[model samples]
Target: SGRVDPVTAARIGKVLGVDALILSTLTTLNVAEVGGISVGPLTVKGVKAEVIITGRVVDATTAEIKDSFEARGEEIEASIKVSDLQGLSFGTTAFNKSVVGKCIREAVENFARNIISNPDRLMTHQIELRGKVVKIVGSKLIVDIGSRSGVRERMTGKLIRMVEVEELQQYVSVPIGEVQVYSVNPDTCILEVLWAEEAPMEGDYVDLISLK
Candidate 1:
């Protein structure tokens, strides 16, 4: 029933280099005492609890709360009946264990759902491309990728060589150079080669190296 402290949230956001935070609160907890059975002279008791969780997503950069929602679920447990007289039979112990497990699972699920629904809270993007090298002129290597897939100027990518082995009859790729996009068109870009052992060819695979 406690909100995540602002100081703690800020620290977490700073560590993750993100601009958002999520806060959760437990609103309701219902406990029910289910009937128990007797094995010989000892009587066992069973209890089940249902929990409701609520949360909110906030943008730490702007200090604005983005979204909020509530989730509720009942604890799960398997039914058991006492059978033996002298020894402890299937009874309240099993139900209590199940209820605890269910509560933990539900809490985890609610936390994960809150994270999955908020996209703006997380902002690391990466893409791998397979395209023709097209041409290499002076200090630039032209590849066949564009702004449609988030390729932009100043972004760094890796130029890889895909080689087909004749004896092994398989194709493999190896990193040959790193390049930064200097200019970008609608469907292509000119990359400035930063480091390379061999010049890129007309057809080669490129991979986005710096994701952040």
Candidate 2:
């Protein structure tokens, strides 16, 4: 096969002064008869062809796999042709080829759409956080948000309390106390009490309100 070799692809990228090159490989191709047609009087039927394609993409600069994708498509019914008078001898070879080409194009388009929709694949950030209390001693509540969630020393958050109503049977969160993030780890953090009229305890709900 005259597929683009890695060395050739790299050389082309360098010549073009490009940062990256996309290389794809056809891994699988499947063709099958799917739909059927009906004939009058004798009640005979015919079939259509469908095609599927799967492939992988690689980056030429680093020779790393960027992504892989798959797609499927069916042939156009009007394109099918018959050769013999007998309904049993139907020709769908052209339809099969068209479907295969369509599937390949559709697969590539779908892959690009997914990448555009999820631009966070390359970078990640901590926007908001929710926490639960695992332990409580006096007025301090130990929360489950750690260093991985961007928590650091001297960070200040708020303590909220959810009060259950017997009439409405709903829980309402009320602001109870202000606390400071004193210490943090990969899995947990300790909160120091700043000012609270009522002390919070274990199993209390904690939320990261804002940085102070």
Write down the lDDT of every candidate, Cα atoms only: 0.67, 0.60
Compared with the true structure, the alpha-carbon lDDT of candidate 2 equals 0.60
lDDT of 2 by residue, 1-212 (tens): 33776567667766786544545545555544433444443333333444444444434465454555555545333323333212332235543245445555566566566556754332222255667778997656789988888777777767778889989899987778878887888989988878775778776766774321
Tens digits of per-residue lDDT, candidate 1, 175-195, equal 899878888788888888788
TM-score of each: 0.43, 0.38
Model 1 spans with C-alpha error above 4 angstroms:
1-122, 209-212
Q: TM-score of predicted model 1?
A: 0.43
RMSD of 2: 14.8
Model 2 scores a TM of: 0.38
Candidate 2 pairs with clashing backbones: none
Cα deviation at 170, candidate 1, in Å, is 1.5
